[model samples]
Target: MSISPGPSNLYILARTMSDGHRSGVAAAGGMAIGSLIYVLLTALGLAAIFRYSPTAYTVLKLCGAAYLIFLGIQTIRASGAGNTSKPKVRIMGMSKVFKQSIVVELTNPKTALFFLAFLPQFVDPQLGQVALQLVILGLLYAILAFSSDLLVVLLSHNLGKWLSSHPLFIRWQDRVAGAILIGLGSYIAWQEFIQK
Candidate 1:
């Protein structure tokens, strides 16, 4: 699950392509923190709120979807503004990127749900101190995830560097990224409203 292709991974790739490796790494750090937060919440039994409260789950999903859509629109608009003599590279603050990544991770209720469902399978009642076991497992998962995201950041940074030289790629990259974000948001919304 740590290495799977999902919104978090795609966001990391897009940020690396658009900004730089530092931005991607910052985003990865935020994601790790977000995962840790979820783990803590799970350990505290707060994550069960989502499982029990349909309204809370729906609200979170909608907020996530809206945020993604907003980001997509912003990206697309930025792409349109870049029709100039030279391809402009937008310099985003790493801290801002990190915060946004955290928001993205936190807004995705599925992540909390995943932890709620996944972490208990390995837990042993015989061992006692179930909360400590959960925290340890969560920490291990976060570390592995951070490692995987770092690998992605390195590879995508290289690819972005290579692609930056091509004017066509430079022109289309933001549009593509925006489209992906929009698609992801729409998919999530669809899953929430249609499937549910």
Candidate 2:
């Protein structure tokens, strides 16, 4: 019989998920709620902001871009300053992370469009209640995500110090993370400007 991946797997995944650097535990924790919120909201037909208007989509993409770029810049600044001991204020903390995740999930028009097209495919109303089915699936996803974050906390507890101390890793992490954010922002902006 095959065994399902458990705590150990999560630990390892979290540890290695990002070049030996880990996302904040609080961020991950908030992401759990964020995931559930998005799923639930999307299911409730509240995620339709993405599909309707070009202007709204553009605005959301810009917002997402700005957030990511700012984070990337902060990462670079932290690495340049060689201060990696404590969690940075912007990315850490339960409340901030929760709010940030929620905004990121909600503000992106793409997410709304995603929910609009995604839910009905597998939802079988004949078998049972639709809302219950959504809750079940969404809960499963949230549990998995929460577990992943816990793993991040445990595995990176020590490794983060080692990785952060290395000059190359810090600079590289910052640059790559930054570039990704900028790219996302540019892409979204481009799509909005050119496509419409």
Supply every candidate's count of residue pairs whose N, Cα or C atoms clash at under 3 angstroms: 0, 0
Of the candidates shown, which would achieve the greatest TM-score relative to the real structure? 1
Cα RMSD to the true fold for all candidates: 1.7, 6.7
lDDT of 1 by residue, 1-196 (tens): 8787777788888788888899999989988988999889888886577668878878888898888887777778878755646647665689988998898787765565668777878889899998899899999999998999999999999999999888878878888888888888888888899966
Worst 10 residues of 1 by lDDT: 82-91
The lDDT, on a scale of 0 to 1, for candidate 1 is 0.83
What lDDT score is found at residue 54 in candidate 2?
A: 54
Per-model TM-score, in order, reads 0.92, 0.62
Q: What stretches of model 2 exceed 4 Å from their correct place?
A: 1-23, 47-58, 77-80, 83-94, 108-114, 148-159, 171-176, 191-195
Model 2 poorest 10 in a row by lDDT: 1-10
lDDT of 2 at 4: 30
lDDT of 2 by residue, 74-132 (tens): 54554455355544333334465446555554544444444445654667989887777
Clash count for candidate 2 is 0
RMSD of 2: 6.7
